[model samples]
Target: MFILADDMGFGDFGVFNGGQSSTPQLDDLSGISRLYSQHTSASPVCAPARAALLTGRYPQRTGVIDTLEARGTDRLALDEFTIADAFSRAGAVTGLVGKWHCGAIGEPYHPLKRGFDEFIGFRGGWQDYWDWTLERNRTPVQADGRYLTDVLGDEAVGFIRRHKHERFFLHVSFNAPHFPYQAPEELIGQHRRTGRTERVAVIYAMIAVMDRAIGRIRQAISDAGLDDDTLIVVTSDNGPELGGDGEESADRWNVGLRGAKQHVFEGGIRLPLVLSQPGVVAAGEDDTFIHLTDWYPSLLTHAGVTPVGSKVLDGRDISGSFTGGTVDDVPRCWQWSRYHPMPTSNAAIRDGRWKLVHPAAAGTLGLTDRDEWIDHDIKRHPENYAQPIDEESPGWPAVGTEPMLFDLAADPEEAHDLAAVHPDVRARLATALHAWYEDVELDRARLVST
Candidate 1:
């Protein structure tokens, strides 16, 4: 059962219904995609998403609900077990081949310390595709400086060749179509000839380059006859860059999704999760609701391994949902954290058509509140993290404000707020959101109780 997820924007592929470019590989794979609706990343941002995706626990419980905005002593706790640890315990080889921004420099939270048998690519999120200044397992790899995308693909293929005989998991994280967005000359030339002033061509070129490199990896797997045994899951860390106008042209980036990356809007949290497992998942789409945390259980189940213990997992194992099982009605939730307090309570609860967003009040920073704090702290207090520190509370302070509600099943764009009209739904979802969060706190206490 191999899943290949791409951080495909809302319109990156043609099969997206409102898709713009032609993503033959993804569109074809979607034949059995299971249309998992309401799937979301843990944080609206990247660092927190990876922290949650790797630990199978909500970022809030793991002290990483926000980005890795540490000065020194504020590092990711070393006691946590990541997905790689689970795979290792289950008797499988685990490796990471991309971005790992979960800790500060030289911290124990490095990928090698996080249970990966092998590590390649940068420890941070973005790196120059042309010049490889990124670190691999905390060592300088001396990037070719010609093009970055090609090198990342090459590394994955090489890793596959070396570990083909083992039941190994390869996490190929690509820093493509990401910032410092630089593609090759041939690709750039091809797009430039397209005659569109809208940098859509450049963005498309970036995706194209990534797709081609990915095809190489896919070919390597097939060549080694590992397609049947390998489970390839490829996806992005978050939504697209929404600034494709005069500023940079990605603002129109998500094609038409409601929000862009960075904030808790749909565009930022809603990413493409493409799973292509031969013989296991029938080629088609399923409209089930799931999220990043769910992948830990779903993949482990498919691999026929039991977890360390029931422990406390925020994600669910819906193996049946992937194997053509019908989906039951369940709601999804989101928490947005950055620097300052999230405008309003800084949470969202989605149940059926009703979706609630705890809006940042008129006087509050709103979307920028939390992010502002982190940014300011990093800038002003960079030296404040020079010494050892005491343990702190587990989660962000709960925001006490009215939530802005919308009917996603009714208004996916979130153009209208129904909070004033549907007080009952708002209250119900609000209660559920808070209770769920409290449960996360309780789990942390039990698992790491002193």
Candidate 2:
């Protein structure tokens, strides 16, 4: 099985959602695959999302509720079992190429120490596309004059060539379409005519490069005749940071899904996910609402691996959705909190078509227990707050009030808040969210105190 994580934007792919940017490769490939119309990472940031993907558990469950950054040396614990470790245990030669934001500059957090036998990537959240600071098992590579996306593709193809004979799990986590979005002259000139500049230009160029690299990876898989043997998975970490570092307007992107990147709205959490395994799983769209935690059990079931959780917490084995099956019965939930006033982008939950969002209610005595996690953590483990949390930092929005709800199927843009219209859904979902968090806190408190 192989995973290709594309840091794509909302309007990036043409197969699932119609778009102006021509992505023929993704379009053609998606048609022969199953698409997740409503998929979300445990958290909207890179490190947290990656943590959830690797552990097959919620990021919060493993203290990865926020993006992993170099500050305070925060990282996934060395003893933690990662998806790559699971694959390795299953006898699959695993490797990770591209961004490794969970943690860097530490042996414990490095992919090599985290169950990946061959690691080719970097530890930073982002780097320049043309001039990158990458690594092969912590050995820095002079990307010299090559574009990052292209370099990653080269490494991926080489890895496949080196390990194609066995069951291998290659995680090609592309950092393109993220930031410092520099591109080749031709692509830039094309977008220049369209008046794309600054962040937009960078985003377009990065996506274009990423798309081309995807073609290379796809071609390599087909050439090795492993297309049928491999389980190809693709998705983005989070939504686009519209105005850059998330301080600007969403402009024409995010497709009116409401909010971007850090919020719990559709645009922030909902993502495009596709999984195809040919004879094992069929093609087409599965309008299922599942979270990153689902991949753990789902992949485990498919590969004959063991469970990551003791009592089947959070996510379910969503692989059934690949064959016209569904995860519609599972109520999708989201909860977020910020340290300050930041456009009311926090706390949300979706039960069926109804989505309830609590926007920055941290100041009120009526603050939900969900928001209390931060307050308690700050007080209980003040040392944990040692990391710098400026706007540019990874784990952000240090503080936030208000709650909103929407029927996403009817209001995908989250234009109208129907919290008043459907108080029962809000109350019940909120209660469930509160109960779940309370349980998590209890377990964490027990572990920490002991």
Candidate 3:
């Protein structure tokens, strides 16, 4: 089971030093799971990061560096080989629940066409948690009154129950704790009484609810006698969404990291990852710089299957790190740009403890707010908030003044810039990252043709 939480931060779970909300179940699971302290998302946004997670390739290669807008045509290319396709070829049943933001505009780009045997979720970036329309393999289903998070969990449990005897790849992607911070009123009140603001309380409540659902899913696995045989991976898509009256709550959720979602800071990409498989994966914590893209190769290797295609994957197989191995010296990269017709030019590089981020000059998409119908009344109700994946404005910052450098080993918060002290290191990383960006740009033809 590959469980993904939308917009959950490193400190959102008690296992990762979260104190704002109660995550008793996750905390307990962390004791038995391999907790990766330095795991990061491929991109800071949702769709691009998820694309990397599924493809084991960078989002730039997958044509998804930005989150998709509502009914947006931008999507994951059809030619890209997905992890699900790899596992299915190895004789495993695949099912995906919750958000499917990769692509939904056309039938060929749907999840079912992308190698998922079953899919129950929406394809947009964000949806109404309380009242929403979900699809079961392309058939729209109306499910009212039930919270979407619990419904997804129940569906995951059902999938597990039905496929207990077979090898199944269930992707439990929950859109919890994202925007539209909706939870049971009583649960929200529980945190509000603790002096947290409405937004903070709702966010905590949503996380608490999702954590309980995760506990249920884990128990179901054990109940079905698949605890030792089944491998479970849980992590967030990106860092927390720190916006709208969250000054006091930001510190609690961010856990001292610098930026939030949309920024290539430690707080945006540095997320917590927990892997549990009973006797297979030993229980412990490690600081492995595992990228979201690494899961494709790692999980495939864990399942003892080799990919069938001659695909160029940027991720490395780090399955050894799960069994008390170290990934101390592995280098990774990240970049982000809004949803546009063209690709992003900026990029970042992580070579061991050194980090470098250089933004690019802003490009024009020739879009105006009048072209899109922005949700204006979502904040009035506790169950709804603004969506974060809308198109970017023209004036948005495309590049930084100069390259920013930090020794993450010494400054995890990225408070100090060591570029002046270490010019050689900065130059080395810049040369490497720009080379990577050029390579990704070359791969854009695959996306454009699709």
Candidate 4:
């Protein structure tokens, strides 16, 4: 069981939030689970992070460099081998319940065609929480008055029950606290009564609802007698979405980590990871630097299934590391921008305790008018936007030419810059980051060209 939350920060967990948000269920689960304190999402944004998570490769290599589906930037290349493909090849029933932002166009990019035998979710980055139009294996299902989060949770429980007798790999993805921040009035009132601003209240309420749903899913798993057999992994796709500056902003407690979603800072990519399996994986905290991509090979190896492709994978099988085994200390890199990727913009590389970042170019930080239109088109008329369309380049001016360096071991919040103090380290990491950009961009170019 792989459970994901959208736009949930480390502070959103009740165990870390100092009780600002309600996540009692997750707090309880944390007691018996192995908490990875230094885990990170592969990307700062949703589509690319998901791409890396599913394919065990960098997002650029998978042709999912950005999140605009109408412009086709979010589509995962068909040639990629997904974790689902690996699990399904091992004869497990694979199901995806919730947001499927990796692709949102034609049937070719659908989850049903991407190794998932069962898919019940939306295929877009954002959706209307109240008037959601979901699909169960390509068949549209209109909202039936239930909250969207509850609906997805119910579907996950049903999947578990139906496949209790068989080997299954279920991905329960919850789009909580992402957008369309709507929650039951009761939940909102509880947070609002605590003096939280309206936006923060709504966001917390949404997360509270999701927390309840997650608890229910866990109960269902236990009821089905899969507690000992199932390996449950809980994590988020990326950091919380901080709204525009104001008291009404969506910002809440984020453990004092710098930056928010769409940034390359620790707060953007750093996330909470919990793995639980009774008597198999011990309960404790592991501060190893684990990336989202690691789950692909790790989980497959844990299930005693060989990876299903000859394609090279960027992730290492760290299943052994869960139980006092050594983890490879390797550098992880991330880059993102609107529309086409800008290698020099919003890019970061972490090699051991040192991190080098090229802050986003100011002009490239937002979506263009056409990008906004494309997003709207995909949400409203997905059929009409099934194919990619040419987009005019923003041609934004570049900034932040000088890279910023931080020693995360001493400054996990990335508050201090060590670039001038450690020029040699900065130069070395910068060269490596540029080389990585060139390599991944070459693969992306080949994929798009063909």
Largest lDDT belongs to which candidate? 4
lDDT tens digits, residues 198-247, model 4? 89988989999898999999999999998999999999999988865555
User: Judged by lDDT against the true structure, how good is candidate 3?
Assistant: 0.79
Report, for every candidate in turn, its global Cα lDDT versus the true structure.
0.65, 0.67, 0.79, 0.89
Model 2 lDDT tens row, 180-290? 557887776555424444456556656767778778888888989997888888888877666534313224455567777666767777777778878878787777778
Give the candidate number with the greatest TM-score: 4
- Per-residue error (Å), model 1, residue 214: 1.3
- Write one digit per residue (lDDT tens) for candidate 1, span 300-349: 77788666544477778877866688756466666754433242455676
Better candidate number, 1 or 4, judged by TM-score: 4
lDDT of 3 by residue, 223-291 (tens): 999999999998999988785655345335567897887767888888878899998898987887889
Score residue 387 of candidate 1 by CA lDDT.
38
Q: Candidate 4 regions off by >4 Å?
A: 193-195, 398-400
lDDT of 4 at 247: 53
Sorted on lDDT, best first, the list reads: 4, 3, 2, 1
TM-score of the candidate numbered 3? Answer: 0.90
What TM-score, over all chains together, does every model reach? 0.84, 0.85, 0.90, 0.98
* Clashes (N, CA, C under 3 Å) per candidate: 39, 12, 0, 0
Question: Model 1: residues >4 Å from true position, as ranges?
Answer: 1-7, 17-24, 31-35, 68-75, 192-199, 244-247, 253-255, 340-345, 360-401, 438-450
- Residue 273, candidate 4: Cα error in Å is 0.6
